[model samples]
Target: MKTYCFLFLIALSITQVNAETSIAILDFELNDLTLKPRTAAEINRTASIKPLLEKELKNAGYRIISIDLAMQQKANSGFGYLFDHNDVAAELGRTAGADYVLIGRLHKPSFLFAYIMGHLIRAKDGQLIGNYISETKGGDEKLTLKGVESIADKIDKDLDNRYTPPPPKHTTLH
Candidate 1:
């Protein structure tokens, strides 16, 4: 009886370990912002979008993760997050045993093109998961948020189907 119980416990533990799937959405790599007039005045809440992406993922039921401080430090010192941190994000995610590591690069139009172009990559094998080269375009950071929303919405929907965590509940005090 004890042997049977031990085997069942081991199986349960294995199942639990396999159930955890983590994903990290790095900062959106934005380029071409420099093209704007020197006095264009930066877009507000632009930095907040990254967290919004993470929130959207969490709301969709994905487990978010943290990268190493050293790698983060190096990545923070650049215009492009991956220019110096691509390998680091992947390596850190892998080292931390993440199932998916999401990285995005923004290729804003040069005031001539009509749409924003973005690159989203998967860290599993360092392959491009998807690209955002839409036909529609808008100028400035607000437009960029819309682009991000579109991309994040697609990913969140896919994740929603794959992993359906308990639906979030809202309650208001009387």
Candidate 2:
């Protein structure tokens, strides 16, 4: 009986480890309030940042929901009006059956500097699980990707710390 119980416990632990968290990545808003005018190409490049973030998160072991599905759900649920509100994001996550949602903005104040800011919200209660900000010099594509990579690394670490089960305590025989 004791052997069967131990085997069952081990099986449960393995099942828990195999479960993957689902996440929804929203489109990043752009805030370029500087005097320098942005060309069409620049705006398009900025808009492309969200996919990079989604890819990074997916690579970090999260199952990322399709943005198209998220948008469709958002419109159906009347959450499109609330924009980036935490509640709205959480609702979208719920609609998509995701465990969490990631929302953020990219700000380019000038031609030389850019900032990436993001927030992770839990879908169950709309709690802010993590917030990250990264600044990188040079607003070019290479620099922007580098900045995003930095922010993604931080987010991955934060999520791992939050969701990873604590190491099991071991007992030593006296």
Candidate 3:
């Protein structure tokens, strides 16, 4: 009986571990507000953020739901469309069978640094769950990757905190 109980417990734990959260990460938009014109390197760096974020989140046990490029481009054509419209993002996530959707942007206000930002939305209800950001000092790939990693870590923590149940209250008869 004890052995059976132990085996059951192990199975339950395994099942829980296998139940990963599904998230659809949209392409990261580049919002360049700098004085200088956008360069090839800047465009390349902007393009890399989505893949890097997907990799980081996947390694953290998130099931990645890929959004089609054509659909994404078509739906989010205007400036800050996906990033600003959580409803559209949620609808897209639902269509893609994802529990959550992440819309990201790399905002460059100056030549010195840029902010990597994301909005996390609950697909079922279209609620904004979290807003995350990390600053990269320069246009280097390594620094941008680090910033992405930081945002990924924060998203993981926020999801855990929001989903975990609160401890039961203890009461004693006087």
Kindly list the per-residue Cα lDDT of model 2 for residues 1-174, writing each as its tens digit.
Answer: 999999999999999887787888777766776776566855776687888777776776778876565474544444223345678778778877989888777777887777887888898898888888889787677767777777777777766533232234578999
Q: Is candidate 1 or candidate 3 better by TM-score?
A: 3
Question: Model 2: which residue pairs collide?
Answer: none
Residue-by-residue lDDT tens digits, candidate 3, 1-174: 999999999999999877889999998888898877478888899999999889888877788999998888888869898888999999999999999999999999999999999999999988999999999998998788888888887788877532222234578999
lDDT of each: 0.55, 0.73, 0.87
Q: Write the per-residue lDDT of candidate 1 for residues 110-153, one digit (tens) a residue.
A: 55433334444456665555554543254455555555556666
| Span of ten consecutive residues with least summed lDDT in model 3 | 160-169
Ranking by TM-score: 3, 2, 1
Evaluated at residue 151, the lDDT of candidate 2 is 74
Candidate 3 versus the native: TM-score? Answer: 0.83
TM per prediction: 0.57, 0.79, 0.83
